[model samples]
Target: MRITNGAGLPAINEAPGAQIAEGPAIVPRSASAVRPAGDATTLRLSHAEMQKLPDVDSERVADIKAALLDGTIVFDASSLAARIARYHGGPQ
Candidate 1:
């Protein structure tokens, strides 16, 4: 169930075809760009935003869990995999 090879990432900077472009790295900042740092930031939680979260259906969840344990639930691995791939911007 685990893919150890998938964990390895190619180092693009050290790759054979990799190129370190030599150009102006730092962009010129405007005079107005330098501003004084503000005071401690205050995080305000919106009640409207909090209320937008969907309420959990405890009974429905329990039924689904029981069905899974009893092997009564119909699960399509390919369909679920496709949905997961689509969600992660992977090939369908």
Candidate 2:
């Protein structure tokens, strides 16, 4: 189902003196609150912090590169595309 930008909204906000009564805020006023989209994404990791990263495997990567260079490994494009599509819940 596709949702339009004006979904759940009236064609015109035809109110002159509409006042929202005082209530608890929908979002909290905190320093770590979520920001709007298109903000600059930055990743600042210190040496000790970077050492704690889980997904970086340089030795395994070097082995894979060597295998690919020596033609011991085959790169299957169709299988890779199918896996990516399944991962993103797209057309299989």
* Candidate with maximal lDDT: 1
Residue 89 lDDT (model 2): 100
The sequence of per-residue lDDT tens digits that candidate 1 reaches over residues 1-89 is 12244557654345576665667868899988775444222222455566777699788999999998899997889999999999999
Superposed by TM-score, candidate 1 places the C-alpha of residue 91 at a distance from the truth, in angstroms, of 1.1
Question: What clash count goes with each model?
Answer: 0, 0
* List of clashing residue pairs for candidate 1: none
Quantify all predictions' global Cα lDDT against the true fold: 0.71, 0.71
TM-scores, one per candidate: 0.33, 0.36
lDDT of 2 by residue, 1-79 (tens): 2223557663253356655456765757786676654353323335557769877699999999999999999899999
Best candidate according to TM-score: 2
C-alpha root-mean-square deviation, candidate 1: 14.6
Error of 1 at 20 (Å): 53
- Candidate 1 backbone overlaps, count: 0
- Whole-structure CA lDDT of model 1: 0.71
